[model samples]
Target chain A: MTATLSRIELMRGLVGMLRDEAVVAGIGNTNFDLYAAGHRSQNFYMLGSMGLAFPIALGVALAQPRRRVIGIEGDGSLLMNLGCLATIAMVAPANLTLVVMDNGVYEITGGQPTASAQRCDFVEVARATGIAHSAWAQDTSDFVRLVQAALERTGPSLIGARIERGPAIAQPPRDPAQIRDRFMQAMGSRKGFGA
Target chain B: MPSDSAWAGVVLAALRKHDVRLAVYVPDKVLIPLIDGVHADPFFTAFTATREEEGVGICAGAWMGGLRSILMMQTSGFGNVPNALASLAVAYQIPVVMLVSERGSLGEVNVGQVWSSRVVAPVCDALGIPHQTIERLEDLAFVVDRSIVQAHATQTPVVLVLSPLLTGGKVFAA
Candidate 1:
């Protein structure tokens, strides 16, 4: 029997998968919506920065080659640093997974239209940059399947998971500074081969 | 006399010796030799990014990932990176070492490069990012190593400017 999953459930499943395999160093963003939706992966939340998730993921992947590095990026955030996909393609780190949550707008700053709304195909851009694998998912099941597949594949991969556009969740009480410290501790661990 | 090729080797060695595992670079004529040298080194993972700001972001991420990373670009490209450096690197305390080729300085033929060159140091200063100019091969190792340390210790971007004389007084080969 096919089981349906909610967006929050899919995110939790993905985070659990990432944590189980020690595949993710951190999940970064300015949107609390991602954090509140049950993502337990270490937060590298951009805080004040709008577009830095992808490059940060690239750096982590390159640095910690033995660990799988996944970025939970927003479509709006991804668009701001779109050139990063080409850089990832050039480096071709087998450990990197870029999961872009595409909800069609900048949900955190209010429901504003993103360039993604203008029909810019992030998947095609990933392909054009020579990223060996790219996937698009429209719902929870699709996200789980595509994300699992992308994580298992080698080299740079991009997953554009279509999410519903909505208001961001209430802001968390955790201080951004504390979150940053926790992320650094997670990333600074030396158990990995490259580290 | 140090040929540009020899200087390139020196720079690459310094980076590796310092354990800089990641490098984010934008294509620049003057930086081609050094970039080629970096690409050939297995000890370092090099990324050719589309813009200077993106390189900065990548370097910051690499730093958080426990890799010492440097950003390489031309002086004219600095204008493309202030926001990334300020908002991302400076604000977040992400250390990124930047190796910038001096442009619009003595013997610069490009008018656009000249205009941007004058503001490079001041901009770096304004951002509170430490910087130094390297004009000779003898100065490369020390300056680069020091900058790397400063960047990591301060958790801020540091710029190492390579003057035309240091890079060779001609356009980088195509």
Candidate 2:
């Protein structure tokens, strides 16, 4: 699919579908877009790390088997830790969903071309890695449909949304501890906070 | 109580006492018994990581989810995971407990293993992550428990380097 969808719009759709589900956003634009689209206590934004959203979300999914967990990562960040796809497949937690924003460039780092910009197919890689519910979102509508399916079905789904080059609309809170505390409280894992 | 098996049991008990629910590891000869013990127990989730970085990622994620986790690797494997430790665990202040098997030390036969073992401690020092070497069986309980507790208390990565003298190292073909 030719990637022309706006990352911000897609992120908004993702946020709109969640009630109490947890979201782990990768570093850079993926984190910024999620915070810009909407901030929730359930969201765990990465401020420094790349290629870790999937693993973090996998842990959340594993710990809270009934709660849906979404991992949002950029193509460049995902490339850095591609083994996580295989690890995710190995554990295959049904409550997790992986959403990769593929802009084909490291947008936060001066727009350097990633492997996806050349010949990498993330959906294919995810599928080969054993995540059966892997696909490319054709557009915004398709993205919403896939997300709806992901939420409805018991699957470790991977959705690779090819996005247009752009900047994140806003920045998230800079404090990592505050972000961690709120998310833990939202998940009811931290005692006496939101409990 | 001076045997490797005795010390391994002590380390395992301390981990359980510290509420470590997940054990993420890359296979290593010195860690086999400890890995088996964690896997056999119902209280822990035993994850076999394809790479050391993946183990670090899993531990980081588990910590964020409020489940205590530990990462197990050999000396050489430590070289593969510093970026994740520095960027994800350290920068994000996610406490990580790493149990690394000392290789290339004492009677190590492999040239590569020896060279890499020398760098692990220096690397941990350079990363500014506190590391302790456990050489005697009696030290297992204190070192293991304290490192895990201190990691959570400080919200930073901590390493426990298991010396060849403690674990008997891994017997090599060469």
Could you say which candidate leads in TM-score? 2
B1-174 per-residue lDDT for model 2 (tens digits)? 234477778888998898888888988988888999998999988888778887877777777777898889999999888788877787778888999998887778789987877777787788889999998887889888888888998888998999878888877676
* Model 1 lDDT per residue over A87-191, tens place: 788878888888777766777667788888777878888999898688676667677787778778888788776666554454444454455455667766323
TM-scores of chain A in all candidate models: 0.80, 0.97
Candidate 2 residues A4-91, lDDT tens each?
8998999998888789989999899999999999899999988765677888888788878888899999999999989999989988
Q: B17-106, model 1: which lDDT tens digit per residue?
A: 788877678878778888887788887777688888878767877777778877898888888888888777877777788888888876
> How does model 1 score on DockQ?
0.64
TM-score of chain B of each: 0.92, 0.95
RMSD of 2: 2.0
Global lDDT of model 2: 0.86
Estimate the TM-score of every prediction: 0.86, 0.94
Model 1 / residue A114 / CA error / Å? 2.4
Docking class of 2: medium
- Off-target runs (Cα >4 Å) in candidate 2 are A191-195, B1-4
In CAPRI terms, model 1 is classed as medium
